[model samples]
Target: MLGKTVKVVAKPRRGTRGAVSPRAARMVLAGAVLAGAVAGCGDEPIKMGAAAVVGDDRITTAKVDRAVLDCEKQFKADQVANQVRTALENQRQQQPTSGEPADCSARSAIDTMLNIEVAAAAAKAAGVSVSESQVDRMIGLMSQQAPAESIVVALGMPKQFTRDVARMNATQGLILQRLGADGNAQSPATLQAQQQALALFRQTAGKLDIKINPRFGSFDANRMTVTPITTRLSATESGVR
Candidate 1:
């Protein structure tokens, strides 16, 4: 059984117009890419100590742990330095008192990496690509709202993976553009386009072999998120027939 589930969606802040802000749009697109049940069983076994496997690539447990630690450290430092509070103030948003759970951080790291892989695959299939310059430009635009490091921490991402986050966002943006989002998130046409893009990503994700280690939790393909697995007693352990 699944325990606590960590779903990562960029909640809209105050003063944002449309159904989704640009930042929120990026997160939503990545998070909602695959909407269905858990990933189907695959023939190839998951590598030992892997956090998750996407096709030929392996997201190692060590990598996840390091990311989580880095995020926590950076967040703590930000709190001490008042960077988070200042950023929230600049953005006219209320501040959060506590950091997210360790499990959630791990899930986030896994999900972000998985989303990047899926986005790349989707782009390749669609004959679309986001250039490095485009990613840099997107990061620059994001930095206009707040410092990149602060934004990274605010998004629950590690500072080290800043470029990865921006690249994923840029790729999704290009995909949505190709799907005719038109920069009007609140418009029906844009919403329809987003839906179409999401469906395309879902199809792309289905064709890839994805697996999550049970220790971290199962991958919920429906939500494109990770859900914690609850330990269950066997029939003999429970004294049942």
Candidate 2:
């Protein structure tokens, strides 16, 4: 679901009572790129025990661990599990693996954190702002199709960060609209708008001086995802004969 480009659905007007179509909700939720395994690069060495560095902010491994734990706990709940199962069935998707240590992996948690940071930066660069009310409204609209927790879990995000995910979705939607994305997501105009938004994200992310620890993975600007480092050894190993 991540790392793949998808259409961005136009947000429903405020005060509208209609629910967002399931297809639209899925597209919007899955639009963000997911982390992949690849080596990362940075201008300087990352701090010890840090997962990744974004601009002046250092996301610690502890934080990622906590979020992963939260996700795991949420996945254990009968309510959450039932909601997720129903939503997946509606979408014709498979169920999550049971007994996994953590439903959200460290790599994914870090990647989601990175995406939130980058999305905020991109919004600022574009001079776009999404209010808490807007985020709530978007969530409300999505809730008609599926509960917010289900949507968050399905997207591999921590349930606690539901608002953050909603805000990012709203902000990106507005940015794309400003970039000339018509209401029709399948149109050529919308495709162009998505490309422009991607460029904006790349540009803003570049200025943030992001660096990922090798223990986890590296950030790939082209794919805008955190990828794992390869373990293949060199011809001479250790760079010396």
Candidate 3:
């Protein structure tokens, strides 16, 4: 699946009163977007300098590291495949280059990993819980959606990547589900909860003196410039890549 592209438009501050700090808003939103990507719940631990305790569960560096790796592998393989395909398409006119592609997969994966950790923490604080079966289904769907070429190799996928991804998906779905239930498409409670959660995220982010690492993604306006955040897409549907 292709990655989603998110467009973030920063409104310029007029006078001092009109000037709300875009930096803080951007940082908080960036955190939220990143959390959204990794909220795919799984039992696997995400690598942490210190084990991040969420309720009774402890997220390990190994589990999150693996998940990040899987995504990285897939993304890099896809990039390579795209390059090859482009070269092959022009092969009749020119020869293809014989050089290895830069590995940015790990960076992307790490971003996802960090986002998930933050989001999971928020979830725990909000008292969100998901079922194992729900997690299973999400994993199955992601596995089915994986690119065909990368499916064959051992590209960073553990035996349990599928299950872990599923758990993450389930967790994300639960959060979204709580925000919107039934086919009506609008729930006052869900909206209120979303607002509350967003506020909580802002408050939490305010407390952490964050330092942005630029090696991950580009931090263009309206896009995820950091690792934990993925680009938001224009599609009305949920789940980008």
Query: For residues 184-239, what per-residue lDDT tens digits would candidate 3 score against the true structure?
Result: 22456555555555555444433432222222232332332232335464312222
Clash numbers, per candidate: 1, 8, 21
Q: Where is model 2 more than 4 Å wrong at Cα?
A: 1-21, 24-40, 78-103, 221-223, 232-241
The TM-score-based order of candidates, best leading, equals 2, 1, 3
Return the TM-score for each candidate structure.
0.71, 0.74, 0.42
**lDDT winner among the candidates?**
2
TM-score, prediction 2: 0.74
lDDT of 1: 0.58
RMSD of each: 8.7, 8.0, 17.4
Pick by lDDT: 2 or 3, better one: 2
How many steric clashes does model 1 contain? Answer: 1
Model 2, range 86-124, lDDT digits (tens) per residue?
A: 444443333232111123677778777777788888889
How does candidate 3 score on lDDT?
0.37
Best by TM-score: 2
- Candidate with more favorable, higher TM-score: 1 or 3: 1
Give per-residue CA lDDT, model 1, range 4-57, as digits (tens). 122222333554322223443233223223322323324344667687787777
